[model samples]
Target: MTAITKGAPRAFVLLRSRRRLDLLDPDPEAWTDEDLAGGLSRTMRWGGASQWEHPLSVAQHSLTVLAIREADGALTAGEGLRELLHDATEFMLGWDCITPLKAQLGEPFRALEARLQTAIDARYRLPRWTPEDYALHKRADRLAAASEAMHVVGWSRVEMRKTLGIAETPLVHDPLSPCAFAPWEPWPPRVAERLFLERFHALDHAHRSELRKLEPELRSSLVLTGAEHAAS
Candidate 1:
């Protein structure tokens, strides 16, 4: 009849029901772009781990990746959405620490989770990822990782070696701290959803203008393929 978490309904997190008292749940629709921003700075270490910052979560990371791609001039609405939903699968599968992202969690798990992410995108009327989309997202993600690693994830290289008995690499600092530029605080999810939706329109217009700048065959191939779908 009902699922419970720590003697309450697990309305936010569906999978935590069995925990019986873990009321922790994340509101999906309430996930404003802020909640989904700035995750690219994360990493999948040899022993990958997941960490959250003050009012900032991994979901935040996804949004940042999208923003980076957009700033780089991804004019396509689908392209923008694709980057935002790159890790959409994690919402269903649970956030994996680096240990899991690597072999520890296994390939099947990642593949299945990835498929689910694609399905979620489709459900939301977002297109699937193309090769360039994946490459672009990964590049942003890696850069994000290096940035976050330096900002968060405590332990300097010397400390890591002395305490954990592990080798460490040097990472440059991000000029901005996690707190300086947050996407979520004052604005609610409704506002973020609206902003992104508007950007979808803007991106569509930009996409077309970009195509006209492409090579003749590249531009012509679009006309031959699903022009109507591509237009949007």
Candidate 2:
């Protein structure tokens, strides 16, 4: 099923939700959280190369990043959601290209990705990352990559540092071990999907609850501003 109408660009894919999403001009509402979770679960990282039977999935990797952040300290719902969805555009693209490959894909690919990400952010109402927060996020992400490289992708610690140029040490313990599938074992796509959806829903609910709590304060602030303008 195509979302593109007559005279529209033919750049769409039918989602598992039975909705069509245009790759070039994505609609935020076109896909559900379930769809995103499924897609991420199916999308493989490290170009689908893994030491385990199943390839490491973006879904699991996303959860790994979230776990790393949580291990550090408590996170606001918004921050947790942002970390979980960092590579969400990959789900829409259906490919998790490595860094060198992304460079080869160039600006057009990046622009499309940015557009899709904007749609996702709008759908989730994710908060904008402050510079400090973004820096910390990058650190956690890189640490996750380093650990995945060694544990799942079968790279040596030396290779991770010298070849992959990852400065962080690979983690000895699996961050997702609490999920209870297996330590350092890549999960089946279905399992990944289920886990991803579970986390997404949990974080999304907390985020919405946070928003609801702020609504009254927001309204009061708006009313105060209006009153000040009237006095002026």
Candidate 3:
């Protein structure tokens, strides 16, 4: 990675929409699903330090988080969309900091992340996170973290709970079923990107209509299935 000179003109990333986006001062209008999917597919969680052969990408992690949220309870389309893109701005920023590290980075980092997140929220038409929303999101996130640490990074459950501050052990795995919190496996980046976009449209009001309008094949992919359909 080439270091940006301190006094130099800032660099811009050209999105698939042919929009030039300033990362330091991003415009919500400059990003799209294609940009998010593509960027996030390539950004790995834990900075690609997992014990697995392939590192878990943030795109796959986002999908997992959304799945956990959906499994939790009945959610409105907007709520589900919020869970899906909770870390959406990280895709554009190209890195995810751990909670401790983020605090250490101080106010400047927080400000930048806040601005980026606000822009991302605007782009997706997601409402601001309510206190209830934060509590819900945090629970699901910690559960996912515990599962990921245990499965992908080979951390012991006790270690995860005590060392990583993950208190949710019940979600570590389901002894009764193979579906829930089974294990973390890295999805192929291309597959992750496509599925992330599919999930986004399935939850996004405008995009859901657009998918039905523009592509029938996409409609099949977007429709709620099995338990989800029943639950909905």
Superposition TM-score, candidate 1 onto the true structure: 0.49
lDDT of 1 by residue, 1-232 (tens): 2343476634343332322111233333433332222122221222333243232244445555666666667346556656656665554444535532456768765665555554555444555567876787777776655444444555465765675444434335332233434422222334333444454446545645554576597767777787777777
Give the TM-score comparing model 3 with the true structure, all chains together.
Answer: 0.77
Ranking by lDDT: 2, 3, 1
Q: Write the per-residue lDDT of candidate 3 for residues 62-178, one digit (tens) a residue.
A: 777777777878877777888888888787778878889998999989988888888887777675688987898888777777777777777787887788777777455521121
TM-score of each: 0.49, 0.93, 0.77
Order of quality (TM-score): 2, 3, 1
Candidate 1 wrongly placed segments (more than 4 Å): 1-55, 99-101, 155-232
State residue 148's C-alpha deviation in candidate 1, in Å: 0.7
Best by lDDT: 2
Predictions in order: lDDT: 0.47, 0.91, 0.75
Q: Which is superior by TM-score, 1 or 2? A: 2
